[model samples]
Target: MSQVFIVTDSTADIPDELVAKYQIHVVPLRVVFDQETYLDGIELSPATFYEKLGKAKVLPTTSQPSPVEFMNVYSQILNDHPGSQIVSIHLSSGMSGTYQSALLGKSMLEDEQTAEITVIDSKSASYGYGLLALHAAQLAQAGKNAEEIEAAVLKLHEQRKLYFLVDTLEYLQKGGRIGKASAVLGTLLNIKPVLSIDNEGIIYAVEKIRGQKKAMERIIQMFEQDFAGQRINIAVGHTANPASAETFISLIETRFELGEVVYPNIGAVIGSHVGFGTIAIFVWPA
Candidate 1:
């Protein structure tokens, strides 16, 4: 094992393959469908969650894991990897309290677990945060110390760009995330919304277009503005539409040279809020 380890919450939407390859520990959030609840990505798979979402009468809700859950995960990591240090990356505190929970968990740790564990609010969501955790894992695997890995992760978190294109605004409206009632009516009238998270990690509508193609094209144009003349690390995530994601990625490749493009299904936690037919893309320096 490496001298350092990485941990993140389910909100990161990291691909299983990469998580397995890096041995990144993931603590799951809870997804509740009325009376039923399941751990995000544990008892609930993305495919099953999306399928149920399409047919459910009511939308599911999500809750962050408790401090006990995080503490247990921290303890398990220390138990499994005896002298290793930990960097616990998590979803933005603005979106959820998972980061604060991690911090509390770390504080409650035994003396041995105290000095080695560091909790970070990624200040981004989906694979935007996933890539940050991945970068830390890479550094850890290369034998970098915890402090060095953390410094690199924070720098990347600041530079990461994330934008999502939703098929409708109903989810945002119903979830009370969209403040304007007009936006909800606009969605019913067939307006696609391009959204991005602010520095505070709250989602905001960047553009509203009449058609899906125009919205996607506009997103591509925005990508060119940020990543033009340089290679970038790109990650594309979807609620359930892989075909749309693949086609969008093809268009992106034609516009800019990419180092590697990771495709991960949007997890149950994010899916519950974004609804179906949402395609989000994240970009950063390679």
Candidate 2:
């Protein structure tokens, strides 16, 4: 039986320490500001990205990892592990081209003497995708075969839920993720829209509430109604909004018995679209 290696893009929002500890390979996306491009989480850290984000006159743009980049990682893994299988998990194709790039890379490696490369579209982002990658890596580390690991992750992926709150609709508006009319209405009503990832990994507005506090309360209420009886692995993501993230964490700790609560800083690619003062909660059924 061959070993299995796990790979994911930087949008997973996984910390560098954990990436190294788990031996997970990451293909970085690019973030461009003012015609200068930097690898997400490679050349730019979250803190640095946010600093420049605030100062820059133009909004940053993001690009997925190229097919060549993905091929490089896959080739190296094949060289190191000989016939090992590779599981490349990534953000949703609906939102980014990372998944498509990975697929192209797999096609390029048809002649390689490996078990196979399985490219999975997490249909989610940030901690939601990170959690799936983490679980897959854990399974790979435990010597599970690629098929088994993929099966395990697929089960968890179906049960995962991501909810987020953005401080301003400007970033989303600029990205064309939300309509201009809706953004204007939201701004006028002081309505903070609570957003979620659908089964397809596409982001959609679930509800619009009056204030940030009410939005948070509404998130907790929805969690209670939908996930009350289930044990969960919770992850809170923030972009320069530690206070709000902490408040969400506190509420979850008080309300549920969770396996663990991970606090990961949102990385540049994700931060660029959501912008500052973004707070998100990722819950996976335990």
Candidate 3:
């Protein structure tokens, strides 16, 4: 492996195969149900989490990894690589404390140890930043240094755009991430909400559509206006809704040229907040 190691949290929702192929290091978050807690994607799979969520009496809660947790992972990577660089990319700080925890984790290291770690707040979620981590690893494998890889990833982040089509408002409202979107709650059952993380990484509603089909179409339309026919790398993140995600990808292909495409299940930490049938589409110029 290259001397530069790319690290990201489970909230990235990167598929297991890609993580293994790229050897990306993932620091998992946690999902809690009553008295039980499980690592985001390690102890609990997205499929299993949704099943438990459906049968549970209370809504499950999610927690960020502690600073010690991050430190342990960092220390291990350094021990193994000896003088390697780590770029720990994480979930949006506006959405969770995970990003802050990572920063604190780096601070806990000695001055010499701290110089090798760079923690970045993705200011994006799921495969939005997951795509960046993947790209960073690809750059590392190409013999690019940490500084060059980080600069490329940051530029990619600025070019990226993502939208989440939530099937219901119940999860968002319950998870306390409703924010200004609370105004759209309690509407008719068919009113699907289109949500996106803003520049500051806060989840906000783009629009409330009358149906799922229309909502997805509006999402594509928004992307068209954003990219305007540039060749792009795209990803589709879903909470156990692959069929819908596939259909959405076909529609996207008709509009813009695609470079690489990734389809990953939205993990438990994020799934608990979006609930089932949530489809998120992320796009960045290739």
Per-model lDDT? 0.85, 0.85, 0.89
Per-model tally of clashing residue pairs: 0, 1, 0
Candidate 1 per-residue lDDT over residues 1-286, each given as its tens digit:
4488898999899899999999899999999897899999999999999988888899988888899888888888888878889999999887788999998888888987888898888877888789999889989988999989999998887877888887767777666655432343547557877788887767777878878888788988987787779888888898867897898888888888889888889989888878888899898988
lDDT of 3 by residue, 135-223 (tens): 99898888888898889999988888999888787898999877768888744868887888888888888888988888889999998
User: What TM-score goes with each of the models?
Assistant: 0.94, 0.95, 0.96
In model 1, which runs have C-alpha deviations exceeding 4 angstroms?
A: 178-185
RMSD of each: 2.0, 1.9, 1.5
lDDT agreement of model 1 with the native:
0.85
Compare the candidates by TM-score and give the number of the best one.
3
- So what's the TM-score on candidate 2? 0.95
Over the full model, what C-alpha lDDT does candidate 3 score relative to the true structure? 0.89
Two-way lDDT contest, 1 vs 3, winner: 3
